[model samples]
Target: MVRRIGLTGGIGSGKSTVAGLLVAQGAVLVDTDAIARSIAQAGGIAMPALEAAFGRSVIAADGGLDRAAMRQIVFADADAKRRLESVLHPLIGTETQRQAAAAGEDAVVVFDVPLLVESGRWRAIVDRVLVVDATEATQRKRVVARSGWTPEAVDAVIAQQAPRRLRRAAADAVIFNESMTLAELETEVRGLWKQWAAATTR
Candidate 1:
């Protein structure tokens, strides 16, 4: 049988990098964020509901979701966040499952969910949870370096996510990706992949 592994981490914890490493190990990846992005594009499945709920202001000139505008609205208002999640979550969930189902047995399927710890529903769906962890300082530094977001903005986002302890508690495996070189990270993931591949194929 295929093994479904849930992968998550705080923003700027190098989760996406780790996921890319895992993919190189002959694993199949089902990424929720990618699916959400797809559905938020022009003429995509989730655009109509988004436009209806938030109006034309949240739509880009190209007829896609104006991500910046939506982000501002949702972060400032809980109800707006909820409404946005209500529109996107089901679609993301459905596509997630569809992709997972299509990964054949003997494949190690990694479900890349950024909010796996907070979602409550993802734990039961995956056989294992792998958390990519980093210190809050590292998280803040990375986000600011890469995204050019203000320190205050990064702080707000980090504050909103699941605390590090809770994510550690939920993890079946954890990758502490703080201040590590890319080569070292890749080596760690490769070693872990051998173990998982053996476990699933055995």
Candidate 2:
């Protein structure tokens, strides 16, 4: 049987970096965010529903989602966010499950979910939850430097996510990423990868 692990963290927590390392070491990564993006792309499965819900304004000239416009609207209106999720979640969920199922019986599959704790749906499916954690200050600084997002904007996103303490409490394993070098982070991930591999084989 494949051991399914839920890998999650807040923005700038280096979750994607950890996921990359695991993939290099043979873990099958089911990235929900990527799936969501694909499903909202030009002529994607979710585009028709999004068009019906928000109209053509939210769809770009290329027929893909106008993500920036939609982001602005959704952030300003809670109802809009819910509406968008309703359109995309079922499709994303179905694709994620299909990808996991295709990873083969002996693989170690990692579901990289940005909102694992907030969603409250992944815990039942994953054998373990690995949170890549960093300090709030670190997260803010990293986001500002990498994305050029205003500090206030970053804070608003953090506010919308589950608190750090709550994520820690929910984690079955955690990688503290603050102040860690890339090499150190890779080493930590490698250790965890070994553990999961052993568990799956047993």
**Against the true structure, whose TM-score is highest?**
1
Clashes of each: 0, 0
Question: Could you tell me which residue pairs clash in candidate 2?
Answer: none
lDDT (tens digit, per residue) of candidate 1 on 1-202? 3388899999999999999999988789999999999999999999999999999999999999998899889889999999999999999989988888898776789999989999999878888889999999999999999999998888888877899999999998899998789999999998888766656755
lDDT for model 2 comes to: 0.91
Q: Give the alpha-carbon lDDT of every model.
A: 0.90, 0.91
| Candidate 2 runs further than 4 Å off | 199-202
- lDDT of candidate model 1 versus the reference: 0.90
lDDT per residue for candidate 2 within 79-152, as digits (tens), equals 99999999999999999989988997787899999999999988999999999999989999999999999998
Q: What's the CA error at residue 59 for candidate 2, in Å?
A: 1.6
Weakest lDDT window of 10 consecutive positions for candidate 2: 193-202
Off by over 4 Å in 1: 199-202
